[model samples]
Target: MDLELRHLKVVTAIAEAGSLTRAAIGLGLAQPALSAQLKRMERALGGELFVRGPRGVRPTELGELVLERARVLVPAVAELQEEARRFGRKRAAGQGQPARYRLGGTHGPLLGGLVDRLASACPGASVTTYTSWSTRELAGLLAEGRIDFVLTGVCGRSRPPSGGGGAALVWREVAVDPVFVMLPEGHVCAAREEVPLAELADACWTNVPGDGCFAQCFAAACARAGFTPEAVYETDTASCVHLVQVGRAVGLCRATFPPTPGLVTRALRGSPLMWRHVLGWHPDSPAARTAEAILAHTRAVHTRAAELSPSYARWRRGHRAAL
Candidate 1:
């Protein structure tokens, strides 16, 4: 029997969880079923993938090599399956069904406005939004055709890498989003309208876990300002906001985010950190036409958002010609 994506998944899961029992639970299979599958996979490959131990299990040298390749293969296969399912659903819905646009991105004011505008512009069409903290992840989905387009942040100082699948994708910048320091309402620096990057050298920071474009931009900016931020906590948007609100740590946010009750956002002095919201899509996909229509509305939505954000507005004024 030939090994398949599922077999590769089993191999990687076993390697990662370090135990067949745990891997079975993660893969939602009974231990015996997983064990049987693993035996078949090992037989097909002519090797033992795991060295069973009293404690758990560890990958053999061959297993480690297989797991490395499986890591990349499994996700690509999964994405292919997901895209097929999505397309099948749309097709089964009939020819009269409205055109569907799947947009994915990080949560931000621009994304919110863009979704609203797209929905308004194409009243009969189905507009779906997917949220991911990582721009590169969103870009990958776009390139895989699982998502029609991506609205994501790209650092001014560092270009966000196109995912492995995004080689043929096109990126269009929609708006500039300046970074802001978010602190507890009563924090010592909260009262200040602008905070210098050096002042927060000793502060604990919260950030999403990823070496994505935004993280690199933040690190580069800190390095230029003569201090590397101590990122003590890694969490998602809601948790990151909560960390700042409860005075546990400071966090960075875009200028366009609406103010939270317990938090105040102060502009970063010297404008060391800034990013642009970009729309990315594969040029050959049907969604490319949808993207053209969306881009027009996106520019208008960003313009309105910039008007509401003083820092973004100031930056926009100077960069008006380029924009």
Candidate 2:
């Protein structure tokens, strides 16, 4: 089509101003040029766009419909143009990958493995991993296209969209690692098959900032165990594994724990507690291929973690006597 945005701009201005003279003045175009552009557009669209009256030019019904579409089309085209320019600049830089990816999660044994696995698998792809304290920050990045994918716990149950007009991002469950109580080798609770909540009823538990979902779950579990927790020290970072390894605190729970060089995991007997991990990416993203590759890598790690649990069970036997 010989159609151009200049035609739409002229028509829209005329419809809004309700006069060709005012529209032409606003657009800095001669009255005849603006009128000619409108005629060209009407001819191309196979309909009359304007009706001239004694007072002014008014949009026809067809013109109203075209104007409505132009409202959306104009900004969408502008954004596409900006994106194309960015892509050109990135290409010129000779960036390592065809697409950029941002992935984030709080540090943990599971996430550590995931980062290594993803980077190794997509060696040519650029992957940025952020250890953030805010879920909203992560969500905002996804919405703004600052990040391609995010791996974290669903902070809590949230309400769905009211109108459901927009596309929902894709989310997949990654792992459900139980919140384990981490303690040093000879703690009394570690000797038991499962650490009883009552056993630590009065124990001073070290608390980390509840910025991530796992930390929130940990706080709730402690409350269910019937105690407002007392923290020996509070750090914005979840360095509980460090505190546990040195026996600074009696115990701490996390979604993923590094295999303590000397520390051990005491499963609390009952409903085996765990935090849900989710992988997410925008459905409309251009990074779909990168997101798919990252998701596949994470799933494989989760599967391998499942297969390796037998080793954990075997290791638990040696720690049983201490419990």
Candidate 3:
């Protein structure tokens, strides 16, 4: 079969993810299907592209060569698509064409408010939002000019991406959201004002299934508290919340998370666990021109949301300088 852009995308996704399972998930494909497709591509190209191991897959010499070409091709294709979209919009509406601003982020309390504010601020512009589990992937999209900006959280010593077209990206810290533990309302520690990380060492935890910044921070905090977290469930944000609500497992959440009816959020005692939320964009992009106002509005929205969380309010009282 002749090669296609989708095939190249799959190869790059697998290489970047370092595992077939992870690549499949990121691409929204089933593992077996992705594996079969990879095999077909290898046969068509007359050689295997990856060195498969029990832990993950790595690019072979041939794979690296192909991947380097794919990287350039894929981003160029994305740029073409973006330009085509602009052309279509202009042709369809003439001088009345609306400016389109694409925004991306993971789950966050201020997301809705931020989107609304952006729309209100640019009356003639259309705002679109995208969601992804990995901020790094979102950054790649920005570098490809697929999105205008992104708002995301980073944990531990994780820094934002700074390469390729993304080298022009500028980031501003909008807020510091302290982490909290979410437990079933009927759990033993649910009534406590604060729960010690060590106290929940034996409890089953619901964990996001990757080594992203948030997961790394969670693992590091658990290690410092003297135990590795026993993750009983690996899932997305919504599932994690459901698991906690049903008493199946405990989970971590940001201060601005809305209170769930069957779950209680408590501050982690003596722990400095927190995620820094940042608004990032290419400095030369049109969206960046209004970034200062957007950031100010985002900060105000997050501050109001954080105040709604009793635990965050208490923490903010002592750490006013950090905010």
Candidate 4:
């Protein structure tokens, strides 16, 4: 309960986002969980940090004092950590140690491919991975030099993480993939090769939660189609697959989502949504030295995935949106 660096981050995130729910999304926590954590934080500090209102929360006098100090400490600690990492890298090279690769990202196909490629290219090297749903969390880790690289995706035209260590990183596009809808093979929509967004207006939906703008983008697209989704169940990828397999809901999937039994993925009409796969790393880090080769490996994985998905391969032949 002692005020820690993580607590400072929570306070800062809520203040910047202006609402508990938005802050929770950005922090990769459920609103209820974030609220509970705030209560604990308040109890430990002996005061409430925010005054909640219908519009959003605002800082009290005490909250302002805490925030002012937190802003200074957070970035200063980040810089110190980066300096330490740089020194460590130099020492490792001086000792003739094997190369080390530390990667972070949410669940996806590209991460695995990149790992395999790096291992093959650098024999006897050390490659490790860390996975999380929060974009800010990953960015924070990268900025602190805890990880060497990140592989993630964004919605059509939406940008990558802009705050929480994201600003210090350089991002490069790995590939652009069309978003696909996954449904039970026997479902009525499965009859069509390309289903309209409006066609599933009444259907319940399920998706894996992540700290990306994808959920918001999906809502916006649904609005354009003249209907709101009846319900959106946020859970893990396996659960999403199970929900779709049981005919309980449709799923938003990447076009490269490998085929599963009883599930068939199809394109949406007009290509209303797309996923932009991107890779990021600190420009000053060792990862930068091999960024070119890493990027090529990732691009090759995307191309291979497309070839494996027959439906995607056939549809892509007639459209260039995914490229």
Candidate 5:
């Protein structure tokens, strides 16, 4: 069967918008033209592509399957166009430009440090950083060639994509940040050189709302300790340090918290206790090299940060002293 680019575009637009009229508006095409394109493509394939309803157009089982395949194929074609445009510019200039790398993560010190290391390592490379979003959204950006790599605190909820999602990206575990409970100097918890999860499970917590990454593990640890957190406030911003400083509430932060006034962080007691933040990328992207570079840089930064941080040094000294 023969097909055209318009056919794929129409299908993808409709799938994304879930309505032909909205799809037409999004694609800047007349509704009739868009409908005709879909109909012709369905006829050529000898089947109906979508079912129309009062609400909107819903993809049939076949349409849903075709749309999934088109999701991968369509973006790939667009990326090829973008790459070709860049390549043509390079050819015109007699010098290929350095590769661009896009990276983002949840708003936190760890991600901030990761971005710093990437910029330092890939000097002259294009870089973009974003904060506050889900990993799945990052995965979508990767598939579309909008971002090269993503480094975020691992939620431990990601399954290896199998059918549709699996085709789009791959995840690699880079480092697991030991869970450190941050407290103000002379706070009750600070009396202990090292605290146990069970010991602090009932502690009043300062949490970011809708944060499945750290929140999930925090909740699980509380459950394991037979108590839940007494969350006094919900926030999704980068104010954990400030909140802890004022003694508003205790919080858990990664190992990379830079020196701040009145803040002390210590690891929770347990073998292999920590939050694992992973790097993500589209496995088939042309920017995979750039992604790999960013990941390598991030790992080095994590190691170096842990080595240099006074909090980590104190932990090591305490552990050795106990031994």
Candidate 6:
């Protein structure tokens, strides 16, 4: 048999773990099965990769050479596989792919608002929404001609993802929103107009999973506030809300999240983290033809969502410069 990615992984695993038996356990394969596979691999490669001993196994000269290459190839192939999976999921979900007026977005309220406005504005066109937690994935889709536009947010001073293959994309600033925390209405900090990040040092947190650097920024903010944050859970939007409502954990959210019966969304004292909304499109795509109109509607929706949140609205009034 020719060497494949899995074979390369087997070689790497054996070298790292120091024995076929141990590697088998780590790989969740029976030792005998692992040995059989190793033998086949060695035969295909025309040499033994290990020297078995009472003390366990050590890499032979050929084994060391193979191990060196396998170490590099395995991780590179693993990265390739991961990227393929992300793109595949997004692609497979699109049966025939692009709609007349298609939009790709990360989780947010603006996407829905834009979809509605697009449908109303272009009465004869079809409006579709493609959602993912990855902004890069959206950029890739735009580059591949699978989507017409993208609406997403970046934390702090982060820039938008670039469309691959030198595709020029035009990104418009729609709104600036402060990241906020959600707490059970009965919590002590819930009564405050602004919750301090340091006060939540003992709190467990949750937020909708996103492929952004916000978690790093959050940790850095906590460091500045003189405390390391407790557990931060990653889950879907509904689960995040449930976690906060039941008091199992608190949540991080955009300032525009609407009020729920038993939970309160409060601004952080220092506005340590901020979310900036942006809409993007390939300048050559048909969507660019009307990007200006869509951007205006997106900004309007963002403003409306912020105004609906009492805490955020109050905070906005006092911190105009910060926003």
TM-score of each: 0.68, 0.59, 0.74, 0.83, 0.64, 0.70
Candidate 3 or 2, higher lDDT:
3
Report the CA-based lDDT of candidate 5 relative to the real structure: 0.67
Clashes of each: 0, 4, 0, 0, 0, 0
For all candidates in order, the CA lDDT equals: 0.76, 0.62, 0.78, 0.85, 0.67, 0.81
When sorted by lDDT, best at the front, the candidate numbers are: 4, 6, 3, 1, 5, 2
> On residues 304-323, what C-alpha lDDT tens digit does candidate 4 reach at each position?
88888877887889786445
Model 5 per-residue lDDT tens digits across residues 94-183: 654355766757666667777676677667767788655455445555655566677776544444221122345767777655667788
The candidates, ranked best first by TM-score, are: 4, 3, 6, 1, 5, 2
Q: Write the per-residue lDDT of candidate 2 for residues 1-323, one digit (tens) a residue.
A: 58765456567778888998998766544577678767778889999998999999877899989899888876686576448546744663565446456776654455667877867876776767777655544554554455667776643342211111132667777755555666678787776656766567666666454333445555676678787666645554346656766777755554244455657766665523555667777665566546667777887876666445543454345455532
**Residues 1-323 of candidate 6: C-alpha lDDT, one tens digit per residue:** 97876577678888888988899766655687689889999899899889999988999999989888987886685567446545654664565333377789988777887787778877877888899987867876776567878999888778777754355678888988889999999999999999889999899999876656787799899899998877989988889999999999999999998878889999998789999899888765545657787788888888888898899999999988876
Error of 1 at 141 (Å): 1.8
> Which residue pairs does candidate 1 place in steric collision?
none
Superposed on all Cα atoms, the candidates' RMSDs to the truth, in angstroms, are: 9.3, 17.3, 6.4, 4.0, 10.7, 10.7
lDDT (tens digit, per residue) of candidate 1 on 1-323: 98866577678878889999998776645587689889998899889999999999998988988998998887787677558756754664555434687888787777788878877867877888999876656766776667887887767745655654225678888867667888898989877777899999988998665434566567788888899877658788899899999888999877776757788877788667877778888765656756677788778977787678655566557656745
Score candidate 2 by TM-score against the native. Answer: 0.59
RMSD of 5: 10.7
Locate the minimum summed-lDDT window of 10 residues in model 2: 158-167
Predicted structure with the largest lDDT when compared to the true one = 4
